[model samples]
Target: MTPAFSLAGISKRYPDFSLRDVSLTLPEGQVMGLVGVNGAG
Candidate 1:
């Protein structure tokens, strides 16, 4: 099996928001959903 989507060693740094070592995977014939909200800055 292979991953349809993936992220490795991903990092983001900021004065307000930060994401580190984020990873994800979606197999074949699968659905993915991403939901998020951003506050006013």
Candidate 2:
């Protein structure tokens, strides 16, 4: 079955912080959470 939520080829860039080639998939009937602690600039 296809995913309920899909993310691909995600990236973020900054002089102090960066995130590259990030990917995630939340399948159907599943719960997911993204947490960032002190991960802010």
Candidate 3:
């Protein structure tokens, strides 16, 4: 089965931080979550 959602080559940048070449995929009937601290990002 194909993925419910897909992401590739994702990136984010800040004067003090950066996220590069990030990728993720969520298949059908699946769940995901992402959490971070108050200062994360």
Candidate 4:
């Protein structure tokens, strides 16, 4: 089966933090969420 959503080699940078080489996949009929603290971005 194919993925409904996909991410590869994703990266994010901030003055105080960073997200490097992040990857994710979501299949069909699925849900995803990113929960963090108030200051997280």
Candidate 5:
């Protein structure tokens, strides 16, 4: 089966810091959350 959403070896550069290699998978019909320290965006 395939994942509803998937990521591999992802990275992003930000003004404060950098997001190193990250990966995740979301199955179908599942909720996901993204949070950071101090409610950072």
Candidate 6:
């Protein structure tokens, strides 16, 4: 079987925040949430 969605070595950088070396996976019939603070971006 294979993942429905995958993120390998993903990264996002900003002046105030940075996300690095991120990895994620999602199979069938699943839910995901992407959360942040009110002032987060």
Cα lDDT listed for each candidate: 0.81, 0.86, 0.91, 0.91, 0.90, 0.86
lDDT of 4 by residue, 1-41 (tens): 79999999999999999999999999999987776797464
Q: lDDT at 6 for candidate 5?
A: 97
**lDDT (Cα, tens digit) per residue for candidate 5, span 1-41:** 67999999999999988988999999999998887787663
What's the residue-level lDDT of 17 in candidate 4?
Answer: 96
Model 1 vs truth, CA RMSD: 3.8
- Candidate 1 regions exceeding 4 Å error are 38-41
Clashes of 3: 0
Instruction: Highest TM-score: give the candidate number.
Output: 4
What is the per-residue lDDT of model 6 for residues 1-41, given as tens digits with 9 covering 90 to 100?
58888889999999998999999999877888776687453
lDDT of 3: 0.91
Residue pairs clashing in model 4 are none
Q: Is 2 or 4 the stronger prediction by TM-score?
A: 4
Candidate 2 regions with alpha-carbon error over 4 angstroms: 38-41
- Per-residue lDDT, model 5, residue 30, is 92
Lowest summed-lDDT stretch of 10 residues in model 4?
32-41
Candidate 1, residues 6-34, lDDT tens digits: the string is 77889999999899998877888899677
lDDT by residue for model 2 over 1-41, one digit each (tens)?
Answer: 89999889899999999989989998899996666687552
Q: What would the TM-scores of all predictions be?
A: 0.64, 0.70, 0.76, 0.77, 0.66, 0.71
TM-score of 3: 0.76
What overall lDDT, based on C-alpha atoms, would model 4 receive against the true structure? 0.91
Residue ranges of candidate 6 with Cα displaced over 4 Å: 39-41
